[model samples]
Target: MRGPVSEGDWRGVVRDVRVTGHRVTKRATHGRDKLLREVAWLKALPPKAVGYFPRVLEVRTGEGWAEYDMDFCPWPDMSRVLVDGTLTVDEAISGTRSLLGFAFDVLYADHHRPAPEDFFHVSYVDKFWRRASAGRGMSERFDRLCSAEQLDIHGRVYPSAASLMRELQRDTVLLARLRPPCLGRFHGDFKYDNVLFEPATGRFLLLDPRGSTVTGDSDSDYMEDLAKLRTCTRGLYDLVRAGAARVSEGEGRISWEWASWAGPALQRFSALDAWLVDELSVKARARRDADWRVRLDVLMPLLLLANAPFQLAPVNPRTEDIALVLHATGVRLLAEALELHGTRDLGVSP
Candidate 1:
C-alpha cells in the first residue's frame, strides 16, 4: 500500500509492504544533506520512542537526491478525520488527553538534561515578523481587510487593522518577559497532520519531528507544540479546508470570511484549555509557583502569532489564504489572551 504525499512540497511518501511485512517511505529533495540531517535526527530518538515513528531501514544519497526507507504504521490521518467530522467529542478529548500524557512522559521526562547542540532554536516571533514585513505592513493590510469585513472584538469595533495589530503587538511585548514553567524535547511540529490515532491500541503516534530549524539547532520551546495544537483547535486548519479563507495571487493578500464559525471553534477548544490549566495548576502547586498559569496564558498568544507566518510560505497557490486565516486566528487568540491578563477564563467559554 502507498499513501499520498503528505501535504507539502518536498514531503516524503508512505508505503506499506505486505509481503515484506513492513512499511517503507522514500523522501527526495533538492538537498540531500538536509534530508540526511532529518533521517539522522529521527534515528537518534530513544528506542522506546522509535515505535511512535517510522523505523529507518535503509538510506541512499546522491547529488540533489536523498532517499531513505522506513517501516510504516497503518493509521488514518487525524486531519482527514477532522475534515470528515467523524471524530466524536469524546474521541477528541481522549486523543488529546492521551497525547498530553504521552508527550509529558516522553519529552518532559528529562527536562534537566542539557539540550543537544543540534536542537533547533525556535524564534517565537520570526514568522509574524517575516509575514508582517512582506507586501504592505501587516497593520495596513489588516486595516484594509477590516474595513471591508466586520470584526467584533469583544463588542468593540476597530476602524482599521492598524488598531488591532497595535493591540496584538502590545500584548506580545508584555509577554516577552515571561518564561515557561518547564522546557524540554518536544515534537517540534505537533499539528494534526503529523498525528495519528490507532483505534485498536488507543495510542497516538507522531510523525516528522523537525530535525533542525533554519538556525541549525532545535527549537526547545515546549510551549510551541502545545500552541500549535491550540491553533488547530482554533480552526485555522478547518477554515482552510472549508474554503472560508481566500488568497489573492501576486500580492500574497489573504482573507477569511468565516465569522460565524469563530465562536464554535473556540468552544471546541474549551475542554483542552481546561485540561491544560488543570495540568499546569498541578505543576504550579507542586513547585509553589502561582505564576505558572500566567506563563501559559501569555505564552499562547505569542505562539499563535508566531504560527501566522508559518502558513504564509510560498508552498502553494493558497499561500495567502493559509496566511490570512492563521494570522486572523492568531490575532483573535492574542486579543483574548490579552483581555484576560493571564486570568483563568482564557476566552474559552464555560
Candidate 2:
C-alpha cells in the first residue's frame, strides 16, 4: 500500500486489504474524485490485461473523497534491485524491452489512444547539445555543486559544462517531420528501475504506467521519432560503457570529479533515454520499414556524441585534450551523416 498520493493540492492513502481470496489495494483521496475514478477504471480492466497491473475490485464515492480497491502484487520494484547492483546488463535490456512492449500493448488495448510525439522526438543527444551549448556559466552551477561534495562518483574529475555542451553540439542535428504510422501501444515510462526481473526464471514484470500517452498519427513523423530514440539508446549505451570504463580504470572507486558530474548527468540521461525507447517501441510495433531503421543506425552515433557532456561534472583540464575529443567526435558524426544523406553546405541557418 502506498500514498497519501497527491494530485496538485489533494492527498490520500492506499491501503492493502484481502477480499474474497484475492489480495487488493485501496486508494482514498480528497477533492480529486477523478483520480480515484481513473484508478478504479484502471483496476477494472480484464484480468489478463490488468494482471500486468493491479485489478480494480470496487469503487466508492463519498461526500468529499473517493476510494477504490485494486489487486496487488508482492514483488519488489526493479529500481531497488538496480541500486543494489543485482541486475546484469542483459537482464536490464531484456527487462526494458519487455516493459516497453507491454506498455505499447496496454495503451492501445485499453485506452485506444496513440503514442505522443515528444516521447519519440526527444533524445539524450538533443539534451547533451543543449546543455553543452549553455557554456561555462551553466556548467559552473553543476561544478560548484560538485566541489561542495553534493555530488560524488568513483573519483574521476568531470568536464566543464561548456566543454561538454560544445562537444554535444559539434556532433548532432535535429530534423522535424510529420508523425509515424501507428504500430501498437506503449508503456510510457520504460526504464531499468521500472521493470522487475525474476532472477530464477529471467522473466520480467513492468511496473508504473502513470506517464503513458498514446497518439495515432502518420508514418513520416513516426519514423523521425524512432530515429531520435535509436540515437538516444546508443547514447545511453555509450554512457554505460564510459561509466564502466571509469569504474574499471579507477580500481573500484570512481574519481570524485567524474562521480559528481557523471552521476546526476547519467541518471537524467537514462530517464530521457527510457522515454525515447518507449516511444520508438510503440512506433516499431505498428509500422515496419528498412530505410527508417537504416537512418536510425546512422543517427545513433551522432546523437550519442551530442548528449555525452551533460552527463558529467566539469573538470579543469588542458584545452588540447578537451578540444581534441570534442572536435574528433563531432566531425566523425557529421561526416557519417553527410556520407549517408549527401553533403549540405555547413553554415549558420537563417
Candidate 3:
C-alpha cells in the first residue's frame, strides 16, 4: 500500500513491491511532473556517465500523479552521517565535487538548455542573492515577526523595521548587480540535506533535482555577478581578520592558554576565509570574458556592506568580524556612491 513519505520539498507516496523476487520500494509524486521529466532525461543520458541517478523501471501517468519505480537502495543522507560524525571532510568534498562536476558537464557539453515552461529550474544561488538584495517585501515580513516579539542583537535591541528594510533594499540592489555566471546546469539547492554518503566506500548520492536549472544570462551580467561575489567574499575574509584581531585584543598576545582554546576557532575562521577566496577566484575567471573592472568598482563594496549583518550572526571569535568588515567595505561603497550620485545623506529615518 502506498503512503505519504515526508521528505524535503517534494511530495511523494511510497509503496512496497516485489521485482524479480527482490523486495523493493516504489515512490510516486503526481503533484510534481518535473521529477518524471528529469528521470526520463537522466535515463536518456549514457548509463555509465549518469550512474549517479536512480535506475528507472517505469513511469506511467495515472489519476493524480506519475508512478515512478526504481531499485530502492536505502541510503542515509549526509545530515545523518554528520550527526553520527562518520563523514570525513575529504569524503564530503569528493562527493559534492562529483555531483557539481556532473551537472556542469551535462549542461555545457550537451547544451541541455532550460525549457520555456521550466521556471522551477531557476538556480538557487541567483534566487538567494536576488531576494536578499530586493529587500522591501522581505524586510516588512521580518519586521512584522520582530514586532510581535522582542528582538535582540549583541546585547542591543534590533534595528527599527524601517532601518532593516532600508538595509535589505540596499543589499538586494548590490547583490543583483553582481551577476555571477551560471555555468550550464546547477544543482539549484546544493546543500548537505539533499546529499547521501556511504562513509565505508566514500560514495555520495545526490537526490532530488527539483531545483536544477539551465543558465540563461548575458556575458556582462555574469561578469558583474562574479565581481560582486568577489567583493562579498573578500568582505567575509576581512570579517575573519577583524574577528582574529578582537580575539587577540581580548586575550593578550602570545599565551599558551589562548593558543589552545583559540586554535580550533582560528581554524574555523581560516576555513571560511579559504573557502571564500577559492570560490571568488573560481567565479572570477568568467569575469575575464567581460568588462569587469567598471562593474566591480561600482558593486563590490555595496555587496560587502549589504551582506555583513547576515554573515556576522554566529558567536565565534569572529562575532564582531562581520561588523568591522561591513564598516570598512561600506566606507568604500558609500564613497563611490557619493562620487557618482553626489552627496545625498539618506540618513536613518524613524
Query: lDDT: which candidate is best?
Result: 1
lDDT of 2 by residue, 270-324 (tens): 6645665555655554645324443554455444444334333233333222322
For residues 3-114, write the lDDT of model 1, one tens digit per residue.
2212223222222223245646566554455567668878888766777777778887766667777766677776656545566556767777777777767765645544
Q: lDDT score, residue 81, model 1? A: 60
RMSD of 2: 11.7
lDDT of 2 at 203: 61
User: What are the Cα lDDT values of the candidates?
Assistant: 0.53, 0.40, 0.40
**Each model's backbone clash number:** 8, 39, 8
- Which residue runs of candidate 2 sit more than 4 Å off their true CA positions? 1-34, 37-48, 60-67, 100-178, 183-185, 211-286, 289-350
Largest TM-score belongs to which candidate?
A: 1
* TM-score to true structure, per model: 0.68, 0.42, 0.46
TM-score of 2: 0.42
Cα lDDT, model 1, residue 344:
24
Quote the lDDT for 242 in model 3: 28
Q: For candidate 1, what's the RMSD? A: 7.8
